[model samples]
Target: MWVFVAAVFALLYVPLFILAAFSLNDSIIVALPFRGFSFEWYSAALDDVDVREAVGNSLLVALAVVPLSVTVGTLAAFGLTRFRFRLKSAVAGLVGAPLVVSWLVMGVGALLLFSALSIPLSLKTIGAVHIMASFPLVTAIVSARLIRFDRSIEEAALDLGALPRTVLARIVLPQLIPSLVASALLVFAWSFNNFTLSFFTAGFETTFPIWVYSNVEHARALPIVNAVSTFVLGVQILLTFLVWYLLRLRPGGRSAAAPLLPGLATTERTDG
Candidate 1:
């Protein structure tokens, strides 16, 4: 088992390690022994107007996706957890199935759907496509957190004279912070790294991944792609660490603690 796990980690991270190393390489073709280390590529990547536009487009897409995904996913989780509705399992599966589907298939389907609807493809259209693709994954993640939740707390909040909106906002939503934030981050990453869907839906407005792919054919722009990837990876790692630190600092510090509500259910060690 240990050997198998080690092999899996190696398979996953070896490529990442190679990319990090090549990002620092002075070679134009990202070949053998590093000729020398220089920030030249990084500088060039930063200065390129096209690279900046692509990065900005990625950020915009992620910004659009995160809120929509979170709102829809949270609502879906609430419905799944709070009410016994028909086709609940089927609904959840349909929402979450995109996580298991191939990106190519999803991309093509999205393109066809949008074309039929006459959405007039653009970066915003791609962002919308990303939201649909990502929402299911967010719903699945948030639903996992909701699964072990206790219903009595919500009832107690209602009994205590809290309005439905108040209970959701002050009681249920607070308890959902960790899971919600986690889902948001994952959705952001998905939107940011998206290639296939964006490629199809975004007919003209290029995103970072699409730009990177295009730049590969342009020999002069090769190193810039690596530089941009390095920068993005660094930013993502920093943000993830910050979120981890803040969650630990949020009045509980990893022990079993009170729920974010006075009358709500206690927060359980969710890992179990």
Candidate 2:
């Protein structure tokens, strides 16, 4: 059993390790035992105008995607989890449909929708599609966290005369920080690395994934591609580490998931 697990992990990760290793190799062709280590490819990747522009565009779209997806997803999660509704089950199915649906189908559907609406494709369109693709994942994450939330704390806050929004802000949101941070990270990574949906919706705008795909067929670009991809992987790892450091284990050593509303969900009351 352990052997099978190890094999599965190796199948998933060994290629990534090799890719990272070759990105540092001082060889133009990505083969071989080893050339001396060099940062030449990394330098070249950073210096390329198209590569920089594509990366910049990807960052722009991902930045836009994170906030919007998180907001819409958090709201959707709250609605689904906190309310009694006629179509609650159906709504959940609709939200989760994107996760099960193939990117190709969604991409094609997005393209058709944009065309029917006569909306010209651009970076905004790309951002829109990314939000569409990513929010369900965000919703799923936040909903999972919310499901385990103790409602007594919330009811106490409300009974103490806290406004609904105040109960949400002070009583509910405080415990949801870790999940929100995780959802943001996932959304950013998803949008930045997206290709198929970006391809359908991007029109003339290029993102990092599109640039990498365009360059993939060229032998001359392989090492530089490796360098850029390695850099992206490092950034993702750093982001993950930073999030864990800041949220999972705080500087003061308290769990970020620890409830802030224990006895402090207080505000003055007014009778009307």
TM-score for each model: 0.83, 0.87
Question: lDDT per residue, candidate 1, 1-272, as tens digits?
Answer: 99999999999888877777788888888778788888888988888999999999999989988999888878877787768878988986787676677778878898898889988898788877777777766666567667767779989989999899998788777877876776677678778877888888888888898888887887767777888888898887887675565455655575422332211112111110
Q: Please, what are the lDDT tens digits per residue for candidate 2 over residues 1-272?
A: 99999999999899999999999999889998889899999999989998899999999999999999999999999899989989899999999887777888889999999999999999999998888778887787778778878999989989999999999889788878877887787678778888888999999989998999999999999998999999998898887666556554633355533442121111101110
Top-scoring candidate (TM-score): 2
RMSD of 1: 6.2
Where does model 1 exceed 4 Å of error? Answer: 1-11, 242-272
C-alpha root-mean-square deviation, each candidate: 6.2, 8.8
For this target, which candidate reaches the highest lDDT against the unseen true structure?
2
Model 1: pairs clashing at backbone N, Cα or C within 3 Å:
none
